[model samples]
Target: MREAYHKELESISEALVEMANLVGSAMGRATGALLDTDLRLAESVIDTEGQVEELQRNLEEQAIAVLARQQPVATDLRVVVTSLRMSADLERCGVLAQHVAKLARRRHPQHAVPRDLRRTILEMGQLAQRLMAQAAEVLITQDVDAALQLERDDDRMDELHRMIFQHLMDERWHHGVETAVDVTLVGRYYERFADHAVSIARRVVYLVTGEHADDYLPDTPVIH
Candidate 1:
């Protein structure tokens, strides 16, 4: 009975890792769809969010069962509770990804990002993919340093976000208000996606060190 109880805890952790992977893929594909204006890809990413949410719900149910049936205490209790919280972060990541895809779908055929700023958006997307990958690794390895690196890397996402606004504010801007709004929303989605990814890493860091870490300061004024 004790062995089975530990196995259930391990399964919850495994499911969290899977959630990280799914959200990462969702954002990556959403980026592609946004850049290429591929409605099909955007639609697929939007569809996958439901599956990620399902995983979150399942993990939550499993965790609640452990709490009620096993009555875990100390480390075991922390593991169950932490898994539940991390699942929330993962769920938010999925929704953010879907928002990106929906933006791509809403502006199909015409690129959501202007040609001048597509490069910046692409960079942000790549950074998000890298961050999520590191987050997933941190989930499995519980490497505090890797988690810290994810926080540092998220700084790039912030920079890219500000760059989007800078382009919109420039005097030569001629993309008009509609496209500008789309670009603004896209930047925000990627920024928030990075935030949740870092949050997941911090969750792991807290789980491991029993304290929140990472305090790197930014030089530039971050956009929101």
Candidate 2:
């Protein structure tokens, strides 16, 4: 029975890794859509969000089954709960990416964002996608150290988010409030996506160490 339970747990882990890969792709596509104003890509992101949610639901049900049937011990219990929370965060990250895509649709044909600002957003998107990929890798390898590295790497995303805001604020001062709101919201979606990725990393820490840890500093000026 214990052996059977262990096999089930391993299956759950594999499922989670699969779900993470899909979520990471969603984030990547959303970012690409935002940068290139690719309406087709944006639509694809929006369409695939349902799939991400479905994967989350399946993971949650599997976790509940493990808890109910096997009654995992402390460590295994932690892994189950952490995975549940991480999947939820990852789902939200996908939603945030879709939100960015929605925004991309709104400003179609009229590129309100400056080319330099678009480049910055592209960098921010890359960082978010990288973090998502790292989170998945940590889960796959069970590498606590890689998870810690991902946690630390979130700081750079925060920095890029800040830069976006500073630029938007500067725009407000110079270009007036015309494009300020759009810029602010775009910066916010990227920052929040990073935040969710960080949350996944922290959950990874919890999964391996049975302790919760955060990667970013508080008091950073958020775009929202």
Candidate 3:
């Protein structure tokens, strides 16, 4: 029974890793499409959203099966609950990517974001993607150290997001109001993407250590 329970745990973790990879790719492609003005890439991100949702559903079903069949207790119960939480986070990440794609589609003929802000937003998105991917690896391998290192990456994403916000606020103060709203919205999307990645990392911590990380916020303070 112990061996069977361990196998079920491993299966649950594997499913989570797959879900994380899908979310990471979606975020990366969304930012890439936005920066490059590639409508096709944006569309790809939009199209893949359904698959992410389906995967989340499947994971939830599998997790429920584990709970029903194994009746996990203590640490095992934490694994089941953490899987559900992480799946929800991954689903939200997909939704954020869809929003980015919608923005990209809206501005197909011209660039939606300003040139100065593009690089930073892209960097933030990339960091979020990296965190998602690394968090999956850490979870699958049960590497607490690697999972903890994701906090640093999340910090970098937060810094980029704050800088983007500052740029938007500066523009709002000095420049006209036309672009500020859209820019702020875009920054918010990216920031929320990073925030979701941090949430996934925290869930992984709970899965491994059986305790939730209290430090949910990234290292950097809000600048704007």
Candidate 4:
């Protein structure tokens, strides 16, 4: 029975990794749809979001069952609880990807991103995907160093998000208010997606090290 309980714990970890992988792929496809204004791809992303949601629900159910039956302790307990939070973050990441896809579908042939800003948006999307992929690695490997690196990586996404707002607020901007709003929303979605990736990585750090990321002092050894 103990062996079975441990196996269930491992399954939870696997599910979290799977969630991360799914959300990462969703963001990548959503970015393509956004850049190319591909309605079909956008529709594909929108339709598949239910898969992410279903995965989250299944994970939660399994986690709750483990907690009730096995009553995990110490690291085992952390694994189950952290997996729950990480799944929540992954679910949110999936939703953000869907939002990006919907924006592409809404804009249709016109393209949601203007040509001048497409490069920045593309960079944001790529960064978001990379961060999520790294987060998944951290989840599976429990590599605290890689998890910490995700925080640094998120800085780039934040920079790109600021760049988008700067262009929108520029007095010389040619795009109308509607286009500006669309760009702003899209930038926010990418930024939040990166944030969720970082959050998941942080949770992994906690699971591995038993140290909450926020508890560290600026020059602490664990962080470096």
- Give the per-residue lDDT digits (tens) of candidate 3, residues 1-224: 98998898888778888888888898889888888889999999988868888989988998898899899898789878888988888888889888988888888867777787778877877777788878778777776556667766677777887787678667355544655666777778877877777777777666666666665335435343
| Ten contiguous residues with the weakest lDDT in model 2 | 215-224
Clashing pairs in 4: none
Better of 1 and 2 by lDDT: 1
Better of 3 and 4 by TM-score: 4
Task: Mark the regions of model 2 whose C-alpha exceeds 4 Å error after superposition.
Answer: 171-178, 214-224
TM-score against native, each model? 0.93, 0.87, 0.87, 0.95
Q: Count the backbone clashes (under 3 Å) in each candidate.
A: 0, 0, 0, 0
- The lDDT of each candidate is 0.87, 0.77, 0.78, 0.89
Comparing 1 and 2 on TM-score, the stronger one: 1
Using lDDT as the yardstick, the better of models 3 and 4 is 4
TM-score of structure candidate 2 = 0.87
Residue 207 error for model 1, in Å?
Answer: 1.4
TM-score winner between 1 and 3, please give it: 1
Please identify which of the two predictions, 1 or 4, would achieve the higher lDDT against the true structure.
4
Clashing pairs in 1: none
Please rank every candidate by lDDT, starting with the best.
4, 1, 3, 2
For residues 1-224, write the lDDT of model 4, one tens digit per residue.
98999899899989988988998999999999999888898999999968988999999999999999999888888788888988988888889999999999999989778899999999999999999999889887888778888887788898888899889989999989889989988999998899999888888777777777777424455433
